[model samples]
Target: MAEVVGPRLYSCCHCRNHVALHDDVISKAFQGRHGRAFLFSHALNIMVGPKEDRQLMTGLHTVADVDCSDCRGVLGWKYERANEETQKYKEGKFILENLNIVKENW
Candidate 1:
């Protein structure tokens, strides 16, 4: 479980719609998406759009762009699965950023 720091919430930047709870945050330093760093967590509350096939060194992978359920702003990508069994660990993983965090009243 992530450190519960009191009333902190996560939401979409554009629409401010609730995305996930603060404790759901897995890592804020996950490196992904065009070699840039982002947040990593389990299946988020965001809506997953159409999936696009991507070719990887390991094998073919499928990823869907996740967006805010309300405003439809692009937040991050969801790693659906890869053709290789060794890459199964990335299945159903989300990569977002700290910007998506909605700070609550302290």
Candidate 2:
């Protein structure tokens, strides 16, 4: 069983929000996902996606291929459509910890 440690520090530049998850919620979510019977996980796919893009000019945009989960629009991955192993890893981390979901759109 992996220990549920709080995030040391997480800040969303776009949203300007930094907070941690409640221990109770973290514990519950962890237990529900941590098991040998079945496992699912979410990962930082810094590849091509809808979120990763920037306007270079009026009619131009740019996107890069890097492992930076926060590279412009490199949001996280979805578990259901993803493979089994990926889903398993998704269990270990919280959604908020992985991406900026509830933060402001800075």
TM-score of each: 0.66, 0.22
RMSD of each: 4.9, 14.6
Compared with the true structure, the alpha-carbon lDDT of candidate 2 equals 0.30
Model 2 spans with C-alpha error above 4 angstroms: 1-7, 19-82, 85-87, 91-106
* The candidate that achieves the highest lDDT relative to the unseen native structure: 1
Compared with the true structure, model 2 gives a TM-score of 0.22
lDDT of 1: 0.67
User: Model 1 over residues 1-106: C-alpha lDDT tens digits?
Assistant: 5565656666676777766655656666565444433445553557898889977545787988888877777777788887788978777877765555454433
| C-alpha local distance difference test of each model | 0.67, 0.30
Instruction: Write one digit per residue (lDDT tens) for candidate 2, span 1-106.
Output: 6664544333333443443323312322322111211111322333334323333222222323222344354222222221244344332333332333222212
The true-versus-predicted C-alpha distance at residue 42 of model 2, in Å, is 11
Stretches of model 1 off by over 4 angstroms after superposition:
1-6, 32-45, 55-60, 84-86, 99-102
Residue 88, model 2: lDDT of 42
Positional deviation of residue 7's Cα in model 2 after best superposition, in angstroms: 7.4
